[model samples]
Target: MPRMLLVTVLALLCSACSSGGDRYDPPGLREVTAANQCMEQCQRHFDSCMTSSSSVDSSDRCGAGVATQRDTRCDTIDNPDLRKRCQASADYCRNRLPALTCGENRSRCVSRCGG
Candidate 1:
């Protein structure tokens, strides 16, 4: 009931973002391509964390999974700076996941790319 409504609402919000441009492509970025790339990475990490949890777990439980994934996943990036950026993005995304749509999340992640 409530879960289905939430899913439908999310779908509508996501569709709105896609209507303008690629969902990950934040506008007016000096490096659109770079921002897009960074956003994609952040989105993947966020989505994976979200899907890993059950409805019973909801956002807080999923947030813990994001933290766990951040440690393991961000450590894999060879570049120390990029690794730090990834972890930071994960932290920001996890903190706000319950309140933001995926497009909003991706937009916020532009900072990780220095955009």
Candidate 2:
């Protein structure tokens, strides 16, 4: 769907940027892959985290778990800004948690970012 397309587009853009090694390290390709994987993981887990009708109810959901996975998921992305970057995706999942059923987390995230 549109969410996948947005992810694909963002991935393509990242790939293009990573290919231009003039700015990144020679091993930056692996880093890009890892970062992408981590983001995907975060998104997935975020969806999982909001399984309840009220995800904001911290007792059932744990932000730390998602934050941990994202922060340590990628070794290449050593910017130490995973929290900041993940916020958009996390916010997307958070806002959508009110749904009675599981919904499109990616679309939520993408839309949250104005995609």
Candidate that scores best on TM-score: 1
Encode model 1's per-residue lDDT on 24-107: one tens digit a residue.
Answer: 644565577777788779878667645653243443544546667776899999999999999887767555544355456656
Model 1 earns a TM-score of 0.30
lDDT of 2 by residue, 7-106 (tens): 9999999998778465544747876677677667656755664554453553234354563454355444656586456655555544444443344555
Clashing pairs in 1: none
Number of clashing pairs per prediction, in order: 0, 0
lDDT of 1: 0.68
Question: Which prediction has the highest lDDT against the true structure?
Answer: 1
